[model samples]
Target: MTAQRSGAGANDGSTHRPRVAVFRPDDDRLRDAVALLDSLGVKPVADSMLAVEPTGALPRDDAAFVVFTSKTGAELVAEEWTAGEETVCAIGEPTAAALREHGISVDVVPETFSSTGLVDALGDSVDGSRVEIARSDHGSDVLPEGLWDAGAYVHETVLYRLVRPDDAGESVRLAAEGDLDAALFTSSLTVEHFLAIADERGQREAAIEGLRAAVVGTIGEPTRETATDHGIDVDVVPHTADFEALTEAVLDRLEGE
Candidate 1:
């Protein structure tokens, strides 16, 4: 089926129908965002960029505090710990809600839903605490480093690996042909994997040239720095790194353009 547009005024004759392409894999966030786009009367084209794979075994010890930055991380931890002695700290409300659904009450919910937000909310609790971070294998070291800096004994268990999707080559090819108006990248891995796919399809430059790219409304300095290094002109980044904010950023950028 053809993708649907969302939100009125997206194509109200004054402006052209804006098309925003999402590079997230099949997940709840992507589905919800697409629904929102449809409500906004904007067409959304999806190309799976990252595939989450369960990586290693969970830690045996009952963690003092379990930290999760992404919903995927929370889900993995929930699967491992049917009932545990850990107090969960989530970076965002949605992830906290996800944990709550699994009978886990989050002890700390960050105000901003970013890694820095987690650190800020954690405060003294992180110091001298035994914290376990559940995340993908290729995630950033910021969380662990921040915990360590706070005097916490932090251990990271790889719950999953973010790998490039199998159909990424075809997606890159399509983007290179200007089939997409803008491509949304939510993570550094998304940026890396998308470029890798483009390279494999021998359309790296074309893909980059054909479409504008936007990062998840909020990202770390390192992620932004990496994007700049790769010559990607980031069109939008939300003040907070949440799906809703990211969607708004997309809409605003589309309107501006």
Candidate 2:
């Protein structure tokens, strides 16, 4: 179903609908993002920057608390594993929902949906517990390190590897030409991959300049920091680190501008 147009704002001064860049994997997520943007009356440039390569491994079976950092991880684990007696922990509601889809009961979901937030949420309770973290190979060291520092015996399983797709730079081309209106970056890796593709195309400087002219929104502080570190001015970061929140904030910012 199409979402209604956000009435008469960013498009007022332009002939065509604003073209926003989206960098989700070419799957249901990408389809949903494009649909959402279309519903908002914006043209979506769907450039999938990431591709998943599963490791064919499962989370360790002995931990007292098993942690899932993403919906992808939760779904992967559920394929061949069960919760058993362990307390299942998800980094956010999406992951929790994925776990539940597999009939796994989630015991914890942090108030904040980040590694640091999960560490804080587990708190003193993990002081003497065994925590198993299952996620991508490129996952941040923050979760494991924090749990280790908090006195939990932490084990990490790389369920997959996030690789940049070879042909994922259409958005970079659009940004370099100043034809794009906005970008929604969901993670630091997406920001990094976008820039890497720009550099490869020898349009890195031009793309950054074009992005500066358009609205750029990141899903969280870390993603915002990544964009800023690469000289792209980030216009918005939603309070919740999710795609829906990032999309709404960005559209709102575009309307206000």
Candidate 3:
């Protein structure tokens, strides 16, 4: 069942409408999440951690396989993909669909949307193969490293750069005022960039203390360590490391507490 909260400006007076800060890049995912929050009478403020920009280059290598881990990555490839010799692999359904939308057929798609999941799905397939991974400039080294260890000749290229958002000043001001009830961190990059913005504005500690946090929840040791280093206690992390899971976890935590 879909959970509902009741409070002033919410469904009823019993539940308070919480203002959530979204610390993601300005993209479709962020827009969808914001719309969902609006439907629930919750206010969502954009504290975008990164801004995306295209790197003008077409992927040309007719490699054995191509890998994509995010919808943005897939879209960037589709913008310049014109080869027929390579098979495409996606980390999630959305990325696969993006490829299909570009009239490209995906050869492999992991059931889960994590790097570990992708590695498991590609287990023996990548051995002795040449795979090209297209992703953001600031992505993790998990996929490339794992593939290399498994005997694949992995080639990587950055298709986009995640820069700090231009309106970050407004976000910092709002956070300083304690207007945001909570902030969602979907990636370690989001956590890092958000803190960087806070630190630049001289409001790091206050921002951390004021807002409740929920991470998209990585199983990676490094992700957990990064969160800890920033002094941000992760309030809720779902079993599945996806945005839907993150939302449910946040809602459950807010309802319970």
Top lDDT prediction, candidate number: 2
Report the alpha-carbon TM-score of model 2 versus the true structure: 0.94
lDDT of 2 at 185: 91
Please provide, for model 1 over 1-257, each residue's C-alpha lDDT reduced to its tens digit, 9 standing for 90 to 100.
Answer: 12223444555554455556676767876688677776777676677778878765564465788887778877777755753677778888878887888888888887877777777778887688899887778768778888888888988878788887776654566568866666666778877887887787788898877655422232445566666679777766667776566777666665564
Q: Give the Å error, residue 220, model 3.
A: 7.6
Candidate rank order under TM-score: 2, 3, 1
Off by over 4 Å in 2: 1-4, 7-15
Candidate number with the higher TM-score (1 or 3): 3
For model 2, how does the per-residue alpha-carbon lDDT over 179-257 read when each residue is reduced to its tens digit?
A: 8889999888999999999888899999999999888999878788888998999999999889999999888887777
**Span of ten consecutive residues with least summed lDDT in model 1:** 1-10
lDDT against true structure, model 3: 0.72
Specify the poorest-scoring 10-residue window by lDDT in model 2. Answer: 1-10
**Please, what is the whole-model Cα lDDT of each candidate in the order they appear?**
0.70, 0.88, 0.72
lDDT of 1 at 112: 73
lDDT of 1: 0.70
- Predicted model with the maximum TM-score: 2
Clashing pairs in 3: 6-15, 7-12, 7-15
